[model samples]
Target: MTIPGHDQSSYRLRLEWGPTGADAVRADYAVVVDVLSFTTTLSVAVERGIEVFPFRWRDARAAEHAMRHAATLAVGRFEALSRGDARHVSLSPASLAEVEGVERLVLPSPNGSSIAFALADAGSSVVGACLRNAAAVARWLAPRVADGASVVVVPAGERWYDDTLRPAAEDLWGAGAVLDALLHGLGVDAAASPEARLAIAAWRAADLPGDLLDCAGGRELSGAGFVADVEIAGQHDVSEVVPVLVGESFRDAATLPPDGPRLRRVGA
Candidate 1:
């Protein structure tokens, strides 16, 4: 139910691995990182004024969820090419570059999407993050973290063929990117857990934009003709948009009213 003895509760900034870790170290806020795509695509979508709904799967439920919101349901990367529509959206951040005439979209994946959905379901104010907007996310959180908001950053790692977590380095870098900005950027000096410090180190160790191209996840996507997506995900701090989950959809934090209500776990 919670971390055995590695509780990071006292720290204002924290880091965790997946859904279970998220629930274990549940805080007043959560940051979901999935740089190979999910959050990268989310950055693109939110920048375009599109509302994104995170779904745990890309099956029938996604279709129904999309329909219920009058939104388009994203298809698989390869499936999008076959859709014959130039605007067909997929998990590929590159594919969403030219999307138009759409407002709401159901974006789903087994990793980050599931994590974001679950964290929100558990009543944590969730923010979708990737390498591209790490600094901006950190800047947004700095003031709040200064005001006593505890954050649990979740790096949604990939799953292996046997369904075990792969602990992908890219996601660690993604989370580290945010933690690094928060610690070194605005002079907030929020208390960071040992786990969060590790992430910050990983972010510094990364070579960025170039190192990601050769990372395992990058090679996998490049080999599959989705290299552009990897490239987009690799760009650091290039976006000013911060996608915060409002109710069930991710909206640009800047666009919402300053006094908007925040979701909080019942007894957390």
Candidate 2:
């Protein structure tokens, strides 16, 4: 299973889309991406006190229905906000929180939700890796590979390109950096090369406070008004909560406090 134009020996990094890609994910590791902020936003919201329920972008009505009856906060975006849409809020976690009396969050985004549904059953652990959680996810994944486990780093690519989304280039690059660090024993400084350096320079020029917002995804997120979420997600080695998909929903594997925020139990 060697993907052309990528390193074939170390591990496989494949870019795919549509139903064919979605079908293939059932037997491989799937890292869903929607770097502009849906995945990042979901990670942040779940880290906070909010619960997330992801659905197909076309299933907006179902998400809205869930929000109305289940106290869920419907979060989505296409172009504009619809009128009299009480349950649906902007994809921003901050904006979603502004709505009064909402509980769980139902999210439908252009890329993230589609990727999630596609890769729902590929990896032993379907983890969401973004630039925000790059280091953390890399650290978490490093030890696992020592067991000779097969891993696939799936980037949620744009609808048009097989390459991962530009905003998600950080994750793809970061994943490669992590693998290089683990296998070839490279340090973070060594990891920061042409692209990484350019990313850092961009971050500094933008007056961004941290390295999280420096990536392609971070810039898109900044425009989307979820810059804070990107900052929080970008923090390295913070929460141990690596959300893994079980059946159809995600569960936090990190040993957080009992009262800590978490996603809804798939069965409970």
Q: What is the per-residue lDDT of model 1 for residues 48-125, given as tens digits with 9 covering 90 to 100?
A: 889999999656788888999999998878788777676778988887887878889999988999999988887789
Separately for all candidates shown, the number of backbone clashes (residues 3 or more apart, or on different chains) is 0, 3
Q: Write the per-residue lDDT of candidate 2 for residues 1-268, one digit (tens) a residue.
A: 2234332223333333333443443223445544455656666655665556666676647655464647464545433334435455656645543555544666666666656755563323466655455556555545544433334455454444663433444444434433443434423222223322443333334332354477655676677655765665454434444555555555554643543233232213
Give the Å shift of residue 245 in candidate 2: 1.1
TM-score of each: 0.95, 0.60
Off by over 4 Å in 2: 1-28, 64-73, 77-89, 96-103, 121-124, 160-168, 171-238, 255-268
Query: Against the correct fold, how does model 2 do in TM-score?
Result: 0.60
Residue pairs in collision within model 1: none
